[model samples]
Target: MLSPFDAHIDAELAQAVATIAHLRRALEETSTPGEAEEVLDLFEKLLRDLERVKPTVIGRTRQHGASWDAVGRSIGMNKDAARKKYNTNNVQRALARIQDGRPATPHPQRAPVHP
Candidate 1:
């Protein structure tokens, strides 16, 4: 089983990815500013938490991000675990790309639309 720190890092990374995905989708569809702000808030928090976790690895936990799966699976995670972990890095990169006015991945969960 992976240590608590590893698990914590993986969770934080996953949340970051999912949040980014959502925000990206919202921007593409011209979502309302209020909804976009909500996702942005969550995304910002995830980024901050990720920076905190990045330096928490004290030993073999320092392996590449690919190692996040085994750590997650040991804690009952599923296939999305791996994809989600890598997406964390991808999320940040994609965000940068979008900020630079480039295309990014379409998010599966976009912010709710109002009538």
Candidate 2:
């Protein structure tokens, strides 16, 4: 079953693909260079939007109990690479919370000690 976040990502990707296809058709049909340029600019903007969302999606996937290895595999990377790239911001945020005297969210639970 797809998680809600996963489903959302899938939907967004589908929409982006549709938009890209429309833009491609528009580009092919354009009679003027200016129109083609406009379509290309739209494509660039769409790419930028996708780039901006990537880290947020990765972070949220981790929060949703995805392992670094899983994330890496999904993105065609290795576990260490994924963690190094995506975990830095999370670490910085946690440090900021600690500095401000607020406990970081989703604190790890310790196992009970038994005699």
> 1-115, model 2: which lDDT tens digit per residue?
8654465457557768887887888888888766666676667656754654466578667887999999999999999998997795764564455456564444343333333
Candidate 1 lDDT by residue in tens digits, 1-115: 8554465556657877887887677667656777666666666655665554443332224345445556556536664764464344554564455356554443344455555
Task: Go through the candidates in order and give each one's C-alpha lDDT.
Answer: 0.54, 0.68
Each prediction's TM-score versus the true structure: 0.39, 0.56
Clashes of each: 0, 0
Q: Give the TM-score of candidate 2.
A: 0.56
Clashing residue pairs found in predicted model 2: none
What lDDT, from 0 to 1, does candidate 2 have?
0.68
